[model samples]
Target: MSPSLTFRPPTTDDAALLLAWRRLPEIAAQSFSDVPDDIDRQRAWIERSNARADYVHRIIQVDGVDVGYGSITVTHAEWRIGTIGVYMGDRRGRTGIGALNFAPMLNHCFHTLGLRKLVNQIFDSNPRVLKGQALLGYRHVGVLKDHALKDGTPRDVHLFEMRAADWAAVRHRFGLFRDMDANVTG
Candidate 1:
C-alpha cells in the first residue's frame, strides 16, 4: 500500500528544511528561482509568500514526515487562472509515487480555490516529469524555445494546462475521490 500523504501550510519554521531540500543539487537544477544561499533570506521569502493573497504554498508530508512542497499562484485573478508547481524534496517519498502526489493540489485548485485553469512549465530535458504531467491529465499547450538558461545553456520549456472543466474526468480516472463524486452527482 502507498504511504498516506498530507499537506499543510508552510510557516517560517519550515524555512530551513525547505531550503535544505532546495539546495539539493538535483532540486536546485530544476528550480526557476535561484536557491537562496542564506537561511535568513529563505525565512524572509517564506514569510512574504505566506502573506500573499494570490499564492498558496504547502508542505507535503508522507506518513507525518515532510517530504515535498507544492504551490499555486494566481497569475490572473480576473480570469481565475493560476500556475502550479511541486517538487519532492525527499527522494524516498518519491519512490513509486509518480503523479499521485499532485492529487490533492489539483483538487484544491479546481474545487476549493475555484480556479478556472492551472498552468505548469517543465524543462524539455526533464522527460520523467513530462510523462508524469501526462499521467495527471495536463495537456501540453506550447513550448517556449530556449526560454531559460540552465547550467550555462539555454533550454526549452514545455507548457501544460489543466482546465476546471476537465477535472472531473481526471479525478475519476485516478480514483482520487473517496465520497466527493457522489456529492457532486447527487
Candidate 2:
C-alpha cells in the first residue's frame, strides 16, 4: 500500500520526542552514535542536520502522533546514492508495518529527489530489520564481520542496497508501483 503516514523534516518542537525515542533501549543498542539525555544536545543535532545538504532527519507521524524516525545520508550526490536508517520508538507490531513506513520514504528518494541507489547496514542482532529489508527489494551486498561494538560486544553488520531499477522491478509486489508510474508518465 502507499503511505498513510506523514513524513516531514524535524523541527525544534520535536526535540523532546526525538530525545526520548533515541533513548529507547532497543534503538540505543543499535545506534552508531550515542543519544545524549540532554534536550539541548538533541536540538543541537537537529541544528547540525539542518546545516548539511546530504543529511536528512525526519520524524514519522501517523495521524499526527509521532511513532518513529527515518533518515537518509547521501554519500554521493553525483552518483545519486545514499544510505537509509529508521527505527520505531513508540509502536510495535507484526513485521510488515515497516513497508508502510518505508515505501513513501523511498518513493521520495527515488522519484522526487532522484536518488539512484540506496544502501543501509543492519546489525546482525536485528534480524527483523533484515527480513523487512529483503521483503522491500533490497539485496544483500556484503557484510562487515564484527566491525562494530554494542555494549562491548562486536556485532556483524550486513549491507543491503537497491538501485532505482531494482526498486522498479519489485514495486508492484509491494504496492509502490502505481504512484511511481503516474509520476513518470503523467
Candidate 3:
C-alpha cells in the first residue's frame, strides 16, 4: 500500500522544526524570504497563523513523521479558487512523498474547497518542481520577468494553474491518483 499521508494544523510546537527546515541552505535558496535564520520571527508567524475560515497552515506528515510544510490560501472563495504551496523540506530524494502529499492536497482543493481553479507561483530556478507540476496537469500561465532575487541574482518566477474539471478527468486517467485509489481498493 502507498504510505499514509496526512496534514495537521501546525502548532506552536512545530515552529522550531519549521525554522530549521526553512534555514536549510537548499530550502532558503528557494524561498522568497532569503534569510538564513529567523527563529523568533518564524515562531511568531506560526502562532499568528493557524486554521481559519479561509486558510490552513499545515505540517506535512508522512507516516506520522513531520517531513514538510503546506499551505492553502483561499482567494476569490465565492468564485471557488485558491493557491496551494508545498515543499518537501526534509529532502529524502526520490521518496515519492511528494506525490502522496500532492494527490490529497489537490483533491482537497477541488473537492472540499469547491474550488474551480488553483494556481501556484514557482521559481524558475526550481525546474524539478516546475516539471512535476506540469506532469500532474498544471499549465504554464505566464512568467514575471526578474520578479524575484535569489543569491543576489535576478530570477524569473513562473505561474501555473489547473482547473478542477480538468483535474477530475485526469485524476485516474493519467495515474495521478492511481496509487492512492489502489490503496483504497486493496
Best-fitting candidate, measured by TM-score?
1
Give RMSD to native, each candidate.
3.0, 3.2, 3.8
Alpha-carbon local distance difference test for all models: 0.81, 0.78, 0.74
Candidate 2 segments exceeding 4 Å error: 1-3, 92-96, 176-186
lDDT of 1 by residue, 65-181 (tens): 888988989999999999888888887568755566677777878777788898898989788888888888889999999999987889899999989887767777765543212
Candidate 1 deviation (Cα RMSD): 3.0
Point out the worst 10-residue segment of candidate 2 by lDDT. 177-186
Question: Candidate 1: lDDT over CA atoms?
Answer: 0.81
Greater lDDT among 1 and 3 belongs to: 1
Go through the candidates in order and give the clash count of each: 0, 0, 0
Between candidates 2 and 3, the one scoring higher on lDDT is 2
Compare candidates 2 and 3 on TM-score and give the better one: 2
TM-score of each: 0.91, 0.87, 0.83
- State residue 85's C-alpha deviation in candidate 2, in Å: 0.8
- Whichever of 1 and 2 has more lDDT, that candidate is 1
Model 2 clash pairs?
A: none
